[model samples]
Structure formats: C-alpha cells, structure tokens
Target: MTDLLHDARVSRGQFLRMMGGLAAAAFATACSTRPQTSTPSGGGQATTELKFIGVSDQKAPMDQLVAAYQKAKPSVRITASYAPTDQVQTSVRTQLGAGNAPDLHVVYPGSGSAMSMSQIAEAGLLADLSAQAWTRSIPEGFKPAFQLDGKTYIHSAGSSVIGAVYNKKAFEQAGVEAPPTTWSEFLSVCDRLKKAGLVPIALGAQTPWVTQLITYALVPSTVYAKDPTFDDKQLAGQTSFAQSGWREAMEMYLELQKRGFFNDNPNGTTFEQQTSMVATGKAAMAVQVSAVLPDFRKAASSPDDLSMFPLPGAGDAASVWIPAGVVVGLGAAAKGANVEEAKAFIDFLGKQENINAWAKAIAAIPLVQDASSTIDPAVESFLPFTKDRAVPFMDQRWPNAEVQPVHFAVIQELLAGESTIDEALRKMDEAYQK
Candidate 1:
C-alpha cells in the first residue's frame, strides 16, 4: 500500500484502495476548512481596537509604544496586558493553541522553543506579515529569525547580541589588564580571577534557558566562523552537532566548569542571583544576552559598574564571531476576530519612527536600516560585528522543539557532574534526529 501510494502509474481508484481505512479515518476526524480572507494590505480600515499582549520585562517600551500608537491612530483603542518572560512564553502557546490567543502577542525568534514564531506558525496560528513594508529593510542574516519558509510571521523591532557581561571592579581586583580578545586569553583571565578568590563566571544552571547562553555566544566563532554553511549542511544531513564545532563549544563550557571558573552550586543559582553576583562585584563576569543589561544595572550600586564585551570564542581575535538575533518580537493571530485591526497596529509598529522609538526605550539595536536609533552604550562594542560577523542563535536553526530542551538538560547534567561531554553531545544528536 505504501509503495502503491507513491507509484506514478497508480490510478485514483488504486490509490484510494491502497489508502483505504487510513483515508476514511482521516476524513472522519477532519474538520471542515474555512477559506481565509486577509484585510487590505494598506493599514486596514483605521482599526477601532487592538488587543496586545507582551512580556512584562518589556512593559515600559511596549506600553509607551501602545500609548503613542493609540494617539497617532486615535480611532483605535489598544488594550494590553504584560507578564513575566516565562509566563508569557507558556501562556501565549496555550492561548494560541486553544484559538483564544490575543489579537497581538510577543513571540520568540525562530524555531524550537516555547512561543517561538516557528512553533506557533507551524500550528497555523500567526498572521502572515510578508506584505509589511518594513520587511524590506531587515538584513538577510536576521530575516531567518522572523521568517519561516520565505514568509514573515513576526516583526522584530530590533536585535540583541549575546556575550560576556563583566564587572570592571572585579577585573581590576584580579589584576587583569584588559578584556581578552582570544579564547586562551579568556581562559587565562578566568584563571586569574579564580586565583584572586573570585567566582570568574556566575552561572545559573537551575534555570534551563540560562544554560544555552554560553554555548550560543561561543558557537559563532567555534562553528559558523569557520563554516557559515554549517546550518545548511546540518539540514542536508551532512553534519551533526556531536561531530561539528558545536561539540567544541560545548566541550569548552565543560572545561570552564572543571576549572572552577563558575560560581559554586550553579545548579541552585537563579538568573537574578547570577546577575547580582556580577553587579555586586562578587563575580568577574557572566555570559548573558545584551537585553538583560538593565537588570544587572538595577542590582549594581552604580549603573556604570557593569559593562559588556564580545566573547572571543576563537583563538584569532580578528576571526572571532558574535552571536546576534532578534529578541522577542511581535506577532498577530491568524484567526482572531480582530485580525485586521491587529495587523494595522503591526504595520504602524513597523514604521521607522515607531521602530526607532521602541528600540531606544528598550535599549535594543533597531532592526530597520533607516531608523535613527542608537544602541545601548553597554553593547556598543558589539557594533563592529553586526555587519558580517554575527551568527544566529544555535538553537534557532534546530529542526524541532525537542532539541533545545535536550541541549539544556544535557548541559545541566554535565555541570552537575552526572554526564561527560560525549554523553551530552550524544543526547543532543539523538534529540536532533527527532
């Protein structure tokens, strides 16, 4: 029957006979399809109302944008709700799946994570944003984060780089002269900090998401810098994480752990605690996404006490690559009753002025090419790499949702002294196949 289904000469009747019970059973459970209709691409009929849901961590900018959007388009009344990052990720997925999703909500970039654009889009939940005018301005490297199958589903106001956020005071205390520009120098700095009786890197392995940051920061140099086509090769079944530069990156992480470079009992530390360690000068540094620099500032005695530097994951400083991608971005629900209104708001949000203003308010790097917005000074060091040296987050190119969690779990196991680099990589390969 399987062979007949693929036979070129098989008649329709023969195909049906081969499919038999499977065909009838599928039809019996299938719901009737409803033709989808999209509102006019020209900012839809002066939307009267919009429902917006966003992460509370981004509330200030999101709220400000909503208010400004409402004033400019006074005909539309926008009501918004915000929650913690973790809660927003979970709730958005549940709501989108239940057909009760918000008219507009925040979605993570790329595939294989909770509330990620790829995951929701695969479920037929996101409104198509391919026609949005600003889509033309997005850089080619960044387009993949907000798009899937050449169709855009989310609109990122900007992007953020991941790197080592360090304490200048702690570095001085350890007698380190400057930020390292190579992997060996970085390890040496770590050794110096550890010898000075300081935690060189504060890690929060108890939070699974935190486990992926260092790997993401390192892999661009370890993997993509050498072979930019690594992900393409991976998709073609020509590569695997266990056998690629990813293994080198993950092994480096394990080496850092073995050398006593991280805070003790990392598995018990929370993200907030890890940030506080560096903010308070108890730790020399931490690998983190640039978006959270504000949280570290809040924990510090002086806002200027903390700053970020690009993590040089390769031995050759000139060849080092930086990790940059869209942070959480906005998405519209495909089947919402107010779909048109939501889309209008999205179009407005993508305007250069709006994108610039939103980027400034959140300390993000604006995505629109013409936007006259400045990046946070803390991340200015990363600007040089933005053009051609940036790589997307490693997991963003993952094949499915199962792979990320597996990567995180295995890393935690390695840090907990329960697994070896080989074991972790093997588990990752197994998950990648699924």
Candidate 2:
C-alpha cells in the first residue's frame, strides 16, 4: 500500500500526496541523535551505535525481534525509531542527508522504479552487506527487491503476497461454496452476495491503497500473458500502466463498482473499517495482502474465518504474487571503526535465528533462503501458484512520479461517478506520457 501508515486526523489523501515530499523532509526533522559534526565514517571497536526505524502498525512480532536483535549484538546499541507507515520513506531519506541515517534501515521497494533512496545507495550512503554468507540463504525469485542489477545492495528479511480476503461465513451466507477463481466466476459470486443483501466487495475508498489492490490482483495476469518479466520491463519504461492489461484491469474495477458491489460510502471508510466490514460479516470480501491476516484476526470473532485467494484473472497460466516486504541496507552515516560492526549487525539479521525472528514476528514469509521458515497456513495454500509466473501490480512499479496520485484520484473519481472508465484511462495515458 505504498508504505503509508495511518496518522490521527490526517486523511489518506493528504498523507500520500505528502509521501514523496514528506519522506525527504521527515528525516531532517527526525531529531538527529547526539549531533555528529563530521561526515567521515566513525572508527573503533567501541560499540558503534545504530539508529533503527520500522513501522508501528506491525506489532507483537517487531517487539520480540528487537529483543532478539539486541541479544545477538550486545556491542551495538540500536535506537529503534518508528512512525506512521507513510512517513518512513521521508524519515530515512532525511536521516541519510543529515548523516544521522541509521547504520541499517528498512526500505520498501517499488517493483522496478528507482527513486531518491536508490540514489543514496548509488552515492555510497549505504553499505553493501550481500557478501555475507547469510544472504546466500535468501531463496531465488524473491531476490529481485534486494539484488539491484546483479550486485546485491539490500537484503529482504521476509515476503508476503497480495490477494482477495473474504469472510467464510459471509460466503456461505451468500450461498458461495468457495471463492471464485476467474473473472466470470468472481462476478457471479459478487452478484449472489449482493442479491443476498450483503455488500459484495468491502472497499475502503478512503484508503486508496486498499482500492488499488484490485488492480494489483489483475495486472500480473495481464503482463504475464505477454511476458513474465513484465514488471521489470515496465520499470525500464518498455510498457506503461495505461497501455497494457492495466486498462482492462481498471475497467474490471469500474465494472464491479457499477454493478453495486462496494459497501456504502467506500471512500469515507478506512482500511481498519474495511477489514471490520468483512470481519463482522457486513460485506463479503476485500482485496488485501497476507500481512493483513493477523489484523483481520484481531478485528474478527475468529481470525480463522478469514481466507485469501489471488485475485481472479485473465491469466492463462496462474494467479499472481506481489511482494509486500522491507529492504534492509547498511547506512551511509555509518562511519568509524564500527563500520564493519554495523555491517556485522546487518549480517547478524540475515542469520537464521534473527531472520526467523523477524519473519515470525510480523507473520512474514521468510524470503531469505532458509529451509526452516514458513508462512501462515492461510497464505500457504496459494504459495505453489506463485512459483511460476506472476506480475507485480502496475502501479507498484509505475515509472512516472505522478502515477500514484493520478491513480488514487482516478479511483476516487470512478467511485464518485465523475469520470467514466475511458476518461480514466485517457488521463492515465497522459500521466504515463509525461
């Protein structure tokens, strides 16, 4: 969901528009710890201090991870920092420029697009920890996010998938024996659920990222049909969000809305409320990530009742798998004799013990090459399908700076009936051309 987090009183719209801009500003504003007057890498075996930042929305597991990490590296002091999800990108960037960037930091990558943060890596603000043996353990297929152009720059601790989440009871109430697997079947299920007096698709229009998942579910099939490396291709500007299956995917979205599938005032709702709609049986299903499972569990009477399916598609091959994980890299601010020590902390994280702790902490699938790590059972059923062909969502990797906001606004407009599907695509085409 573009790494955005909910902040008190701030609407999702205001939050995301500020993401690219604020991400740069936040780090500068993040109180620099014990001011360092020099840019030279600090030296010494003296326990090098490392500042860390992670998202607060994910709990339970994170606290345990912090404890485990501290236990492993007694010599290094980590001042863990956390903020609303949307603020992280800005915060990290600010710290880097301020020379207070943590020795190791968390990054969420867009499938192919490289932005300001990657430039930091190019500038040597980040240390390359890939030479460590632990990284060799991260499995294949999941390495793209960390391995930029063959030379590994970042390391992924775990991985997750994007798909549709539904209430088992609601499906039964709608007389659906199982979740649909194809577009026609899905539409039929939506129709039955709607006829049964339930909102067919629970949408949090207020949190536009939630609405974007529908396209995420669809784009993979569209891209994979012509090329498996479609995501990488788009990242290179070989194709565009508006030119390919994206149009059909977006059309499917409008079709669902026009069919009266969404809950009332979807745009006014938040992701928390959208999950609640399915959890409480107010609606039939929602398009969400596997990471969303634990949250649904907390929101519902029985978390076990919530299940996932890769979004139904145009794929001749299989359903899609999209990455929803973090990228950890050594900091440019890391100087001194402890530079290697900071490198050691990152290496330590890749170890089976720390990697397992991080994955299980957040209920994440260890993307690292560890044979022992596993994902939640609900998400496990679909893992086999992810093995072959799948496309990352078009917007997740869209090259244009304006794509995210333009897509967000277009979806809202579609919901408001202010724009037709054709007009929406036309606008998208204009943005991509820019």
Candidate 3:
C-alpha cells in the first residue's frame, strides 16, 4: 500500500477490472451497527457532539445520512456545515493546521490537492480507518485513493464521471433531438442553442475548481484515447502537457469561448449562477461532475428536466471518451477529542444501506454494491465507456499537490486572455517537476 501510494498509479487493466466489478457485483445483505456510547458519570444520558465541515456536493447525502444516524444513535449528535469547494479547502485546511479542526472534514480522494486523503494522512492529521469493516471492501484499483501506508483515511461512496449536464427542454427548444456523438456534432448543437437564444454552456470560471472541468472532460478523449499510458509517461518525464494532447484539449476549450458559446462574462459568473442558468433553461448545459447532479436537480423545476451525456471530445465517435474517478469524501481528524465517536460515525456510514443512501443522494454508484444499490439513470449512457475509454481524474495520478492548482490557475488565465496554451502548460510542467 505504501509503494502504491508513492507510485500513485493504477494500470488500465486494473482500472477496467475495478469498473467491471462495480458493474457486476451482487452481494449478500449487510446489516447496520450503531456506534457504542457510554452513560455520563452523573447518571444522565451521555451525549457526544461532533462537528463536520464539507463541500457543497456533500450536503444532500450528509443531510440524509446524518438524520438517519441521529435517529439510530440519539446519544451522538453531529452538526455538519457545507461551503463551496474553494472556501472549504482553504478554511478546513487552516483549521487542520491550527490543531482546531472539526471532528471530521471534507477530503478529496487520492493525493491531488492540499486536503486530499494522502496529503492529510501524510501530515498525521487524518485518523486511520483501516479497522473499519468497509475498508476491507474497497476495490483493489481504488485503494490508493482511500489509503496511505496501508491504512484507510477517507470514505467515499463511489466514483462519478465528468460530462455535460444538459436541460432536455432547452435542447428541445434549440431543435436538438439528441445528444451529440462527435465533436463536430457537439459544435452544431451548441451553435443551434446559441441561435435559439440560450447559452450553449454555462461556465462559472470565477470559481477556481469549476475551471478544470472542461479540460478534464476533454483530456481522456484527446490524450488517453490515443495513449492510455499518458499518466505513466508524464510521471516518467517522457512527455508533458505542452507536448501532448493537453494542448488540443486546451485549444478545444477556448474554441467554445471564441465562438461565444458560453454565458456572457463567464469569468464573472459564480457556480450558483451557472447551476441556475442550466436548471432554469437559460443555458443548455454545463460541463460538470455527475456528483453535483442533485444540486442541479434541486435548483430545477423538475429534476427530470436535466440529464447527462458524455461530452464528445473527438471528431470520431469511436475516439470519444470520458473522465471517471472517485468522488470527494470525508475523513476524521486524528487529534480531535471525539476521535472514537467520529470513527464510530464513519463506521456506521460503512453499512451497505448507508452507502446506498449516500450514493443515491448524489447519483453515484455505490463503492461496493448489493441488491439494494442503485445507479442513477442519467449516468447509464456512460457505462459503455467507463471500462475502457475512461481515465481517472488527472490530478489523482499527479506526483505532487502543486500541479492541480497550477492547472486551475492556468485555465483561468487562459480564459481571461492573459495566457496562451504554451505558457499555461509550461507553468503546469514547472509545478509538476517541483
């Protein structure tokens, strides 16, 4: 596990097998167990209060599961709050550094960012979750995302894909009958939407993390579809973003904006505004992770108004691919006073029923499925590509934390016309080598 963590690599075969298992697994029913609690010394019912800070994508699932946990374990109380990704990453990391972290906080899978599971675990800030029963069930290819040094530190329900979340009514309004299957067709669809007076794509570039989705959606088809070993090559210093399909992906991203397909003043728009635009049919679609489908649904007049389709990044349908990776999750703080209680709560979440609940709320596939597990219909179109064409989110295999933020910043700069693809990739390469 330590070697795997250090390597941060999962081969294409392994990844495919993991996806196969997720699609085929049929398991026996698993039961839920409540965390143990002790009575107060004064003889009154003892209560333990736990604090959790997570990102917006987690709110729906956490709200549902938290209520269920409270109902089952009245002695333990959890107060969870959520904020946008950029804010949570800054504030929660600060809390962790100051030794005043919440009992549990948001953790991204793999070692991509400052608050990723491996990064926090390496700093001795995350508690070991290896003892939990659910840790035993993590797919072999996904272990690197949840574990470091052979110990589980994070709990994510399942993986999600990055794609175009479109409003069906808006598509109809533009005279588009179906999702496009090729890059040229996609452009035609966008052109029609624009002609119909709808924003073809709702890009909220003002939000740092949202800036990367367009590139992420394109890279698998532009880069990995041609060379599946791209990550390995990049890790070995055999190639770079400036020297590969990443340039094409970046150019394709700008081509959309160059044609005025995006909402007006994208750099000034917020993620909330982007969601509202698509949900309300003011915009036809947004390139986003499937995990946030619930947020889009919540903001819409009818959840069924929206659905997802793989963004075709190549001119040929056969060459198109998608990005699928572990969703962001939470971890318990190692130094918290309620460490055991926090662990117990995580343990409770480990139950198959709770995993189903969490995954269902966010439209994710359950990490380990049983008869009860359900995959959202919106993502069904992506299943055919997941086993072969999909790649893990690029950051998951990045050698260090610096590269992702650099990627984010460069995208923003490129969007603002302050940088070129050459300069942007060069900046990312420098960060990668750091």
Candidate 4:
C-alpha cells in the first residue's frame, strides 16, 4: 500500500483557494508564551524557548500534550500556535519559505499534501528522527509516510481512516438492519432511508473541500485496491484519470445524486450544516474523516449516536479497502532556534502514555507498534481494513498541487449539474499534465 510516492508540490494559488480567499489573519492567532530558561531532560541542555504549530481541530489534545511536556520539563517554554487544518498547512509552507518556520510543526505523514513530511524533508527543513527510540517500534508499513530517502523525520502518534459516519438511531428507525458491505446494498439502504422520510446522505458541497470526500472514500476499493501501482503509473504518465478506475468511482458519486440520495442543494450546504444533519437525525449518513468524530458527537444529544463503517465500494464483502493515512504528525524544524529542545519535546511526545493520550483525544489508531492504545469504538468496525485492505488518500499522491483544486472545482460543478463525470475526469487529467 505504501509502494508509490506522490508529488507534494504546494502552489501559492492552491493555498489561496484552500482558504476560500480568506486573509492570513482570518486564521487563528498564534498562541505564544513568555520565554523562560530552565533545564530539560536528556542530559545536557540550556534554558530554551520553542515555537510550535499544530492543527486547530486537535488543539484540545495538543494543549494536553503541551501542558504535559512543560510539566515534565519546566525548563523549556513553547509558544504553540494552531490554525484550521488547511490554514496550518498554508501557514507552515509560507513561513517555512520565509526562513522563519516554527521550531516544530504539524506535517502530513507521507508524500501527500502541501505540508507532507517528504515535502519538508526534501527541502532539507526537517531534523532527522530516524535514531529516536520510539521509531524502532513502528511497523514497516507506517514508516514510509514519515521517512524520505530512508531517513525518518515526522513523529506521528497514530493514523486515521475516512468512512461514512452514520446516525445509529436513524438507521434503526429506517429499518436498515446492518451497514451495507457492497455498493448495491449501499444504494438499497439509501433507498430505504429515503422511503422512511430521511435524507439518505447529507453533503455540504459549499465547503469545496468536502466535495472530495466521497471520491476519496470510494477510490480505495475502485482504484488502488485494483492496482496499487495506479498512482505510480499516473506519476510516470502511463495513465490518466479519464482512462483509469477513477471514472468508475466517480460514476458511483453521480449514481447517488441521480437517485436523489443526497440532500437537496448539496452545492449550497456548509460542512457545519452537513454534520448537523446527521447529528440531529435529519440524515442517515455522511462521508467524513475520522478525526471529526468528536465534532459529530458534540453536536449530538448522545455522544454514541454516531458510528463509522468502511465505504462499501467493492461489489461484494470480500476484503474491502478503506482510505486511511497518518493524518498529521510532528516534525522539528531543521533551522529553528531551539532545535535540541524541540527534538526533546518531540521525543517526550513519543512516550507510551503521551502517544495513547494523543490517539484517544483525537480518535486515531495508534501508530506505535507496542502501544496499548486502541481506536474509538465508533471507528472499530473499520479497523480490519487498516491492517492490509487500506489505501492512502489518492489526492495526496497527485502529480501537481493544482490537481486538488481541479478535483474540488470539477466535483462541485458536477454536483451542481454544471459538469459531467467524463468532463471532470478530463479536467483532472489536464491538471496532471500541467
């Protein structure tokens, strides 16, 4: 599953579109702390101050990590800054390019995304973490995302899967006996939900990024599982989106729309509205990232109201594939002022207790090999797929940064009846050429 590497170039225009034309200041303000001098663990050290950045949605758990680290080693002061996920990526890229990156920052595990580990490592911006003790325990399959040219840089505590988060009570009310394990059954279930006066699927395409979730969820079984080399071929110019399995995966998306399984005006719905629909039982299901499970639970009257299942893209139940990856992890900036101290904090974050705590706080599957951490029960049903039946998010491996924007735009247009699947795929292929 980790055989092919994707292009990780992040363009300025891509960052701008990701923020929906929002100004840099529209992102959360950077949280800083007063500089203090104190000795840190790991023997010889000086009173050091560290600047850090992280994903805002996971701020709760990250705050716990900061507090824990400071408590254990009072000599080091960290000014931790967090932004919305996309903003974090953009900010890090912009800041890193300006030669003023944080001491430590969030990075995607592998060769995907604008702020992926490989991108930073390739730029010679990440401190090597290959010799760290915690790294020895990580399974081989999980190593590639954090490594570049056989050297490790990122210290990710866990991984995440993308799947459909469904309202349990709504399913029972709709007379849906079980989660579907095949595409046909999935459509049948949606029909039943609609018959029972429920929205089959709530899609908020107004948040353009949300438009890619359905495609990502289905491609694991449709494209990667069929040929793990599909991405490699794409990078080598041996294949095109219009001529590959992407057509089938996307046709499934059109099938849902054609069958009226999606909520009316998906093009007008915001992500918040989409989550609210499932939380309030207005919709039976939603395709979403596992990291946002807590958000879904918080908006619900009962936290257990939601559970996730692998998207049934395969025709039958025989070893279905899931979209999964090392969602986000930490990497020490190579040219920061407090390199040693930052590396120390990163090491502390790799401890068994910290890894488990971080994983639990964010509802992720622990990447540490011997850690006792377990995934959330809501996501447990899809665990089997993660072992060997999972594929990394396809967009992460795209040849050009512009490919994602093309993906978002084409999907939005398709959802709005402004484009067709063939046209969308052709546009993606053209983006790859650029």
TM-score of each: 0.86, 0.80, 0.85, 0.87
Q: In model 3, what lDDT does residue 75 have? A: 85
Prediction 4 global C-alpha lDDT: 0.85
Report the C-alpha lDDT of model 1 over 338-393, residue by residue, as the tens digit: 88788888898898888887787666789864636677888899999999999888
RMSD vs true structure, all candidates: 12.1, 10.4, 16.9, 11.6
Worst 10 residues of 2 by lDDT: 108-117
Model 4 spans > 4 angstroms off: 1-46, 369-371
The superposed Cα distance between candidate 1 and the true structure at residue 238, in angstroms, equals 1.0
Select the stronger candidate by TM-score from 2 and 4.
4
Q: lDDT per model, in order?
A: 0.86, 0.67, 0.91, 0.85
Global local distance difference test of model 3:
0.91
After TM-score superposition, the amount by which residue 7's alpha carbon in candidate 4 deviates from its true location, in angstroms, is 58
Sort by lDDT, top down from the best:
3, 1, 4, 2
The better-scoring model by lDDT among 2 and 3 is 3
The order of the candidates by TM-score, greatest first, is: 4, 1, 3, 2
Report the candidate with higher TM-score, 1 versus 4: 4
Cα-based lDDT at residue 79, candidate 3: 89
Q: Write the per-residue lDDT of candidate 4 for residues 168-271, one digit (tens) a residue.
A: 99999998888999988999999999999999999999998799999999988888888888878988988888888789989999999999999999999999
Clash number for each model: 0, 18, 0, 2
Q: Which wins on lDDT, candidate 1 or candidate 2?
A: 1
lDDT of 2 by residue, 104-197 (tens): 5665443322232245556566566668887676556545555555555565566667777888899998789976767788889999999999
